[model samples]
Target chain A: MFLPGRRLSLVLGTALAVGAFAWFFASGERNIPDTEGGLDGNGQAGVFAAAAGAALVSGLVLSSLTNALRLPGKPLEIGLDGLNGATYLQALSGLVAEVSRSWRRQIQQYFSG
Target chain B: MAVLVSDYFIPAIFALVLFSLWFAGRDRVEREAHQRAVGISMTALGIANLAVQVINSVYFRPRPFVQYELDLLFYRPTDSSFPANPAALTFAIATGVWGGNRRVGAALYALAVLYGLSRVYAGVFYPSDILAGAAIGVVVALLVSKLFLLLEPLPTIVLRLARRLYLA
Candidate 1:
């Protein structure tokens, strides 16, 4: 028996640790340069910083708006269960009919206009 | 350690995406939705990365290794350093998943942060670069996820195909 939850948690924990260690040590490196002029010596760090901040703020706002609206969630089920040739053909035909109906409606609207 | 953080971490980030996909696949009910979310998120990430590239072209930032003599663990890139590409992609994927699954999303976000910080540690990118990348990624993910909901038929078609192929 394999425990996916436990394994995933372990992996996530390790990744976080590695990332933390890197950030901590990287900050202390002597070769690192001053942030006064930005990384490229072109003073673009300010611009990048502003853009990054804007993006974060916008993302948060959008996420909250969507959540508050109580948007319907989609299903994410994926597996190879209950599929056979008959069902495949049935689905295919249904799809074709749906496409044909949509096209016919568009054509009718175009000609009537 | 520097080499591991800078060079090896790249593959690890990719592995994280794969793991995320697999984890989503395990969801018997929401697998298709999760897959759709992943697709939309990746598409958004791709577009954002292209946008970042355009920005980088306008503003060229030199890598830390290029400015100072440091023991670089990886090959020095001649690209713009203001917005890190890897950080952008990882964060985009993480944020996209987060919209669908909170637990996994949180984990992925943590990984994205780690990846961003590691790039700085590796001396290939500046902290600002990582920050910009992450911001772009998150915004794109949020916007794309919302936009994708309007195109519900697209995912329905994909789900139908997956079902036909016995892939649920």
Candidate 2:
């Protein structure tokens, strides 16, 4: 049972961890004497894996800490949007049509001017 | 600044921004929309990578640092420099988010441009490569977003399942 606020914190932590590792790998830890320190194929993969692990650990720690803090009221649940299959299809179709209409209008305006 | 940005800072920001959006929004509706953008961006990124690979296999261009002696800010890469991979990837993400949220999308676009310029400044890629990469990314993202829209109910179904597991 993950609280909404904790879940948010977890994601934020993961993002930060991943970003920090990427920067560190590409910039801070880049000066190797023998090699020019460019990211080769293997190096890139290692960086990604390491960053992911770091993100997971950091996210978990942040979420656990947030849970321990136990902020005042219960957070709101992130419920479903209630858009079923049919409604979902309808919404997409409407969006496409709207985009098309807008494009047409823009084209007309361009030609008119 | 150019070295830091060209090396990894901007790309990292892209990931961070996308991750933040994935879990953002007040209600399920908004959150779902944001997630959809992130999904689209990820798919576009995959496609962009494939495109870059295909192009690299077909056409090989030397890196700017390799072609001429210049003050190189970053390390030398062995990969072909025809279509800048970072540029394509960042632009793909920007375009993907643009379809869902214009403001964020525009901001991403700006960052993408900056990333391309930074790469050029670092002597990793040519202007032509960056332009080509940006074009490929934008086109791929637009096409993927349209395709996702066409495949409507399928995405919604997947999202619902993820939501059930609290993974969405």
Candidate 3:
């Protein structure tokens, strides 16, 4: 059932990862911005921001592929139960739950008072 | 601000990485798998960071402090600023964990951004340098995650040796 999804993820992830790497190395050789004389203020920011965006997109796409490939042939469960590690999801959810529980207690106390 | 940027920021980032490791350790059921994944991710990150160094050597660029006199926090480095090393390392780790857990990945990604911005704010790196570094880190991580299965034999051998020594 999930084979098609896995295959699609594998294909898309590989393509994005390869394409991003190629683009970066191919165009990364330009001379550093001549900001010595303060000629192009923020040029560095602009360039780096664009690069960061590209990197982020590539990373997310590739990560999705990894997840898709890893999670097949198993029951779908959220959090870090996939591999048995304390996943980021687990930590974050725990923190959120704790906070929310505390908040709820506080609200109840206030209303009861 | 200077103290935070110079003295505390790097340590804070390190702490974040440690925290992730500690989090992985807390899981009794998937502990082994999580640790293995972390190991794989970190090894990949090291390789990617080394590649960045090679790239830096080929295309040298001065640090922002070397280029301009800004509010300096730490002693200036003589390394190339084309790709920010800190950004690369942090992003690589983030991307590594991201494959296993999205929420954790997102948190690490946020931390990576903060670290990059702090480097820029400290006038140590240019914005583009951080971006480029992050991009490289991401690419390396993705490749590693995708090809991890192919590299399984290497770890399996290490595990066998460790088991022999009763160290695994």
Candidate 4:
């Protein structure tokens, strides 16, 4: 639920991913022996081609999640009709109240550390 | 004074960033403009990445460290290397996503550049591969974003085509 600046997210995500890839490769243990001396032309080609396929599927999955069950804040649903200052302020205040009620402790933990 | 920034690490870092952007592009977009801009841009670059990779199926360009036996601190790509797909995708997504909120755009660009740097520092890809790929990505994304802007309020034409193409 953390919404970092998009740039930070991209950087952190890339760092995390590269680190994870290293971890996986180091721990995979399956190809180490065969690949140590270096994969032959065809073997290397196969490994990358296979990995590209996996990357494609993974990319698709990241963009298309169903938001039906997500925490609601549908901007489209909240059109400007009757959306004046009082009602909007009330709504925001209510949101703060609800969050404080549920996630106050988590927020405290996040900052206090 | 080029102490590091060898071939292998740079490309590896770029690859990592590309993968991350692809991951973000797939997430549920709160705003359609941001979503479509990022989505089409990254996906296209990603596909371009795949195409370059296919060429690697034959190219097998050696890493600089490997050629010089420098033993840099990074993992080597098993596949052939040319036209670094990862670098291409990272810059492409950054430019594509730049049309978003100003804060968001600046952040994405900075992140993309960092990712690019990490690749060179990692000793994974050649400078040329990274540069060329990044340039292509940025140019294409700019064009694509412009087209999306011109076609906003996504008409029946786009939605219908998207559906028929199974992209929607």
lDDT of each: 0.62, 0.73, 0.61, 0.53
Tens digits of per-residue lDDT for model 1, B133-161: 98998888888887888888887787777
Q: What is the TM-score of chain B alone in each candidate?
A: 0.85, 0.94, 0.79, 0.63
Q: What is the DockQ of each candidate?
A: 0.11, 0.06, 0.02, 0.04
Clashing pairs in 1: A75-B33, A76-B30, A76-B31, A76-B32, A76-B33, A77-B29, A77-B30, A77-B31, A77-B32
Alpha-carbon shift of residue B41 in model 3 (angstroms): 2.1
Ranking of all candidate structures by their TM-score, best first = 2, 1, 3, 4
User: What TM-score against the true fold does each predicted structure earn?
Assistant: 0.57, 0.70, 0.52, 0.47
Ranking by lDDT: 2, 1, 3, 4
C-alpha RMSD of each candidate structure in angstroms: 14.5, 14.1, 17.0, 14.6
By TM-score, the best candidate is: 2
Model 4 clash count equals 21
i-RMS, each model, one decimal:
10.5, 9.6, 14.9, 13.1
Is candidate 3 or 4 superior in lDDT?
3
Query: Please, what are the lDDT tens digits per residue for candidate 2 over residues A1-113?
Result: 13455568578767757786666776665534225645643365357557755864575455445543443322233232322211222333444676799999999999999
In terms of lDDT, the poorest run of 10 residues in model 3 chain A is A82-91
lDDT, candidate 4, at A5: 55
**Per-residue CA lDDT of candidate 1, range A13-113, in tens?**
56765786478456754222334321431223244346545744463355434443242322122233332112323333455676799999999999999
Best by lDDT: 2
Query: Which stretches of model 4 miss by more than 4 angstroms?
Result: A1-113, B1-30, B54-60, B146-168
Cα deviation of B16 in candidate 1 (Å)?
5.8
